[model samples]
Target chain A: MAGQPPKVDVPILKDLTIDNITENVHRINSQGSDPRLKYILERLVTHLHDFARETRLSTDEWMAGIEFLTAVGKKCTDVRQEFILLSDTLGLSLLVDSIDHPKPPSSTEGTVLGPYHTHDAHDLDLGSAISGDPSGTPLLCLCTVKATSGAPIADAKVDIWETDSKGSYDVQYSDYSGEPDGRAVIKSDKEGVFWFKAIVPVPYSIPFDGPVGKMLKVLGRHSWRPSHMHFMFEKGGFDRLITTLFLRGDPYETSDAVFGVKDSLVIELGTVSAEQAKKYGVEEGTKLLTHDFVLVTDEETRKLRDEEALKAMRKLGREGMTIINGQLVPDVD
Target chain B: MAGQPPKVDVPILKDLTIDNITENVHRINSQGSDPRLKYILERLVTHLHDFARETRLSTDEWMAGIEFLTAVGKKCTDVRQEFILLSDTLGLSLLVDSIDHPKPPSSTEGTVLGPYHTHDAHDLDLGSAISGDPSGTPLLCLCTVKATSGAPIADAKVDIWETDSKGSYDVQYSDYSGEPDGRAVIKSDKEGVFWFKAIVPVPYSIPFDGPVGKMLKVLGRHSWRPSHMHFMFEKGGFDRLITTLFLRGDPYETSDAVFGVKDSLVIELGTVSAEQAKKYGVEEGTKLLTHDFVLVTDEETRKLRDEEALKAMRKLGREGMTIINGQLVPDVD
Candidate 1:
C-alpha cells in the first residue's frame, strides 16, 4: 500500500439522517456515567432509529407517538402507572422480566410486575389471613422458600399481593373505597414456610380507561390479565425472585394479555371444609393452595440465567414472521 | 377438506414476543376513527415493536426512554416546546415539512418550520424594520412572490422571523430580557413585492437547557441550527410554503443540525450603500437579499410531490447498512 487512505472522522459527521443517527449512537463516548446505563441507552437508540427506518415513519406519525406518550405520562399518578401498563400491554415488560429474573429448572418463573405491588406489604404471621374482608371465594396460601440445593432459606422475605376474587387490585379499589385490602407480606420461618388466608385470584382486565386500554381495543385484543397472585422472595446472598402464581384452571390462564402465566407457577386449589377453615379463623368452605419456590444458590447462576434468557428471547423475536402493512414478511434480525 | 381446522382468532393471541407484537400491529382496525390516523398508527406500532425486538431492549433501557420522555413533557410550557425541539434535532421536522408541502421544481422547497413562527406578524408597510435593536449587523430583505406560471401572487401574507446576529430568537430572550422583539408579518403589495429591514440571519444552536439538550450532549452531536430566516407565504389557492433561507456560505449550511437546509433556500447577501439603507429607514451599512419564490398553484401537485418525496426519503432510510452488536445486519423491513 503505497498510499494510505486518509482517515475520515466518520462518527462526528452529524448528518442527521437515520444513517447518521446509527453512527452517532455507537460513537457516544461517555466520559463519565454508569457504563451499564450507557450500554442500554446506546442499544436503545440503535433499535429506535432502525425502527424509524424500517417503517419509513412520517413526521405526523412521529408526532402522534409523542402525543400519545405525553398523554400516558399525564395519566400517571401515585396509584396509576400508565408506563408500566404500556410496557405490559406491548409485551416489552415480559421480555424484560423474562430476561431480568430468569428461572433455572425447578425454580419459580416470574411474570409481569403488574402496577399493583406496594412495598409496604403488612407483615403477617405464619398461617394468618391476608385480607380481613369476607368477600368472594375464601382461599388460603401456604408457601415454602428454599435454595435450589434443597436447603431451607430461613428468614427470607416473601412479599405477596393479589387481586380480590373480583379481580381488582387494592390500589384501584382504594381510590374510591378505603385502603386496599387483599395484600400482605410474611417472612419464611425456620422451616422456610409462610402461609396466609385470602381471596382467590380471578381473571381481571387491566384498567382500560386510559391510552393503553384504547390501544388494546384498537388492536382487537383483550386487556385481560390472567388471574394470578404476585410474589417476590428476597434474601441476602441469594438471587431475588419476582413471580406470579396462576390458578390452574382460570379461563384466561392460557391467554394472559401480558403473557405472565407460566407452567410452574400454576397451582390447583383444593376445597377445605368449614371445620378446617374455622381452625384458621376464616370463613367456611375455603380453598387452599400450596406452593414451593426454588431459588438459584449463587449470583453467577442468576447472571448466567439472565444472559441465556436474553439470547433465547432475542432468537424468538428474530424467528417470528413479521407483518407490515397487511403483508407477511420474515423478520430480519 | 375432510377435516376443518379449529378456527383460532389469530390476532387476539397476546404472546408477548416480537413476533406477536408484529402480528397484533397488522390486526388493528378502525370501526370509526379517522381512517388515515388509524392506518398511520398501525404502521407506527409495527415499526416500534420491531425496533424493540431488533435491539432486544432490556427493561432498564425501556424505562430510561420513558423517563426521558416524561422529563421532556414536564419541561414543556407555554413559552417552550421541548417536543418540537426534539423533533427538529432528530430531523423529523424536515421530513414532515417536505411531505406536508411539496415543492414543484420551479417552486420554493420548504424546510423545517422551526418552532418560532408566530403568525401574528405586525402588518408592516413595505419598508419597515423587524428589529428596532441597534446592537447587531443591519440587513434589508426584498421578496417577490409569484406563481409557477410567472404570475404575481398579490395579497399573499409573508410572515417572517429570525434570530438577531447574536443568534438568539426573541421568544428565548423575552423571558429574561423582556418582550420577544425579532418577528413581524408584512403583506406583499399588489405587485407581489415586500421588503423589511432587520438583522441578517445567523447560525444558532437550539435552546439546549432541557432533557433534549442532555440527550444531544450524550449522543455526541451538536445542537446548532444553521442560520436562516423562517418564511411562510400563504394565499387562498396556492399551497402554503414554509421555508428558511440560509446565508449562502455559512460554514454550518451543509451540516444543519435539523437537516433544514435546501439548495434553493440558501441565498447570498449583497451589501447596500448607506444612502440606500437610509431609503429603507434602516442603519447606514445594511445587508440586502433579493429572492423570488415560485408557488405551486394547484392542490394535486402538492399531494403528488409529497407522495413522491416520502417514497424517496423512506428509501434513503432503508438503504443504510445497519450494524447491531458489531454485526452488519440487514434491517427487517
Candidate 2:
C-alpha cells in the first residue's frame, strides 16, 4: 500500500441522528457514564430518543424541547414551580410518588404529592372547614376512621383543605387569608368520627402563566386539574400519607391534569333526607360527601406532642429554627 | 388514646438532617425515588448528597445550589450549553470521554471532548497550515505513523486543529481567524509522515462569560486549559483514533482547567538546530516538534471498506454523498 492513494474519510453524520434509538440507547448505556446518574439518564435518554424517533424529530424540534424545559425552570418561584407542574402533567409526579410510597394493604392508597403540601396543617375544631368563601354549593364533609381490620380508631387526626365556594384555594388568590390558617387538623370524637362544612369543589385549571402552560399549549392539551381536596393524615402507628381526593363527577376526572385521581379515591356524597338535612342545618339537595378513612395499624410511628400555644410548643424540648419568614418547629411526639 | 391531649397529636419534626456520608451512599446504592430512574439517580444523588455533606452545606446553601443549577439551565442557548461547561469543571467531561472512546493498546489516548466538536473536520493539503496570522511564532508539526510492530503504514488520514495565538476556537469567537480552518483532515505521505507549519501552542482558558463563569467564581476556581492540539486519525483496515498532543511545559500542565491533561499525551517540542531549521526553510530559533503515532491494526478491520466509497472507487456503484450545512449534497464530496 506504499503508493496507494490516501484512504477516503467519509463523514457519517447521519449515524448520529435518532433514527436508531436502540443503538443510541446502547451507546449511552455501554459508555462509561456516571454510575449514579446512569439509570435515570439511561431511561430518560431512551425515552427521549424513542420519542424523537417516534416523531421523526427534527433538530429544531429537539431544540424547542430544550427551550420549553428551560422556560419551565425559569418560571419556578417561592410559591410556584412550573417544572413540578410539568412533572405533574407528564405523569412523573404520580410515578415518583408511587415509587416512594408503596400502597399498604388496608390503609387508603397514597396519591400524587401535589405541589401545595408545603406547610404543616394546624390543629382545628372537629367541625372546622378550610374554605371560608360563601359563593359555591354547600357541602358537609363527614370524616370517620377505622383500622384496616374494621376496628374503630378514635381521635385520629384529620387535616383537610379544599377550594372555596368560587373554586379557588386560599393559596391561589393574590391575597392569602393566612399561610396555614385555611388548612386544619381535626381529631375524631368519641364515635371515631369528625365532620366539617364546606362548599362543593368546582374543577379549575392550573395556573397557565408559566412555561409549563406554554408546553400544554404546544402539545394542544388542557392544563386543568379536577376539583379536589388535599389531605395529609398522620395517625398513631401508620405511614404518613400525602394525597388528594377529586370530585367524582368533575369534567376533568378522567383526564385529571395531574393523573392523580384513582377509582378507590372517588367518594359519593349520599343524599340525606330533607328532614335529616334540616336537623343538621343544611338543605336536602345540598351535596354531602361521607368518607370513612381507614388507617393501617401495623406501622409504627414516632409522634411529637404539641403544646397549648405556639410559644409553649416552641419550648417543648426543641430549638426553633427560622426559615425565610416561617418558624420550623421539629415535630417531637 | 381517646382522651389524648389536643397538643399530643403533633408529631415531632426531628432535626432529620442527613449527616452521615456513608449512610447516604448506602441509601443511594439501595433506593432512589423512582425505580426507573433509580440506578442513574442513585449515583447522581449519591454524588450530590456527598458533595453537600462534604461541604457541611446549609439549607439556604442547598437552596442556592438548586437555584444555581436552575440558572444554568435557564441560561443555555441554542448554540451554547452552560451545563456542559459545568460538567467540564467538575471533571465530568473527561469521565464521559473516557467511557465513550476507551483507547486501544497502541493508539494515542484521547482527551476531553470539548463542547465545540459539533461537526466533522475539513481536510487540507500536506503543505498547507491553518495559521493565517503573520506575527505568531512559526513552528512545524511532523507526524509519523507506524504500526504496533514498528512497520510504517502509509496513506493514513490525520485530522488536526489548535487555537490561534490569541487562544480561542473559531466557534467561541466567531471571527474565523481564531477558528480552525483546514484543521480536520491531513494525509500521510509515502513515508508514513505528515507535516505542517504553524505557531507554537499557548495555554488558554475556556470562555467565562456565562453561568459557567459565574459558577467558577462561586467555587473560587480558575478556567485555564493546558496548550494542546486536537487530532483524529483513521485509515482503511484500522481503528479510528481520536486524541490530542499536549505541550509539555504549558502553564496549566498540572492544573488543566477541565482536568483533561494526561501524562501519556504530553510531547516535547525541542528547539531545531539552525542547520535543520534552514533545511526546512525556516528562520533560526524556529521550533520543530516530532510526534510518532502508533496505530493498532487487526484482521477484522483489514477487510472493511466503505461500501459506497469503495463502489465509487471501483466504478460499480452510486457515488458517495456530501453535506454542506446539515443537509445531503448531490454533487460535492
lDDT of 1 by residue, A1-333 (tens): 111111232233343333454554345333224444344455445555545554445555666776777678677777778878887766567766665555676666666777878876678778777766667677877678888778988999888888776677778864545454677778999999878877878878888888877766765566676678888888988777778888877666655666676666778888776886777676565688788988775475556654563565457554544333222233445
**Across residues B1-333, which tens digit of lDDT does each residue of candidate 2 receive?**
211112322222111123332232233133222232233333333443433322223333334544665777776654466666665565444544443334455666666656555454567777577666565677787778877677787989887777767776656664444335425577888888888877777777776777767655443345667778877778876666666788887656655656666778888997768886776766667777789887765442222212222333234232444322322223432
- Measured against the true chain A, the candidates' chain A TM-scores are 0.83, 0.69
Task: Compose the digit string of candidate 2's lDDT tens values, residues A43-117.
Answer: 334443333322222233334544665676667666666656765665445544443344555667667665565
Docking class of 1: incorrect
lDDT of 2 at B68: 66
Candidate 2 segments exceeding 4 Å error = A1-63, A104-107, A177-182, A272-285, A297-333, B1-333
For every candidate, the chain B TM-score is 0.84, 0.67
Instruction: Give each prediction's root-mean-square deviation over alpha carbons.
Output: 8.8, 16.7
Looking at every candidate separately, what fraction of the true A–B Cα contacts under 8 Å does it contain?
0.12, 0.04
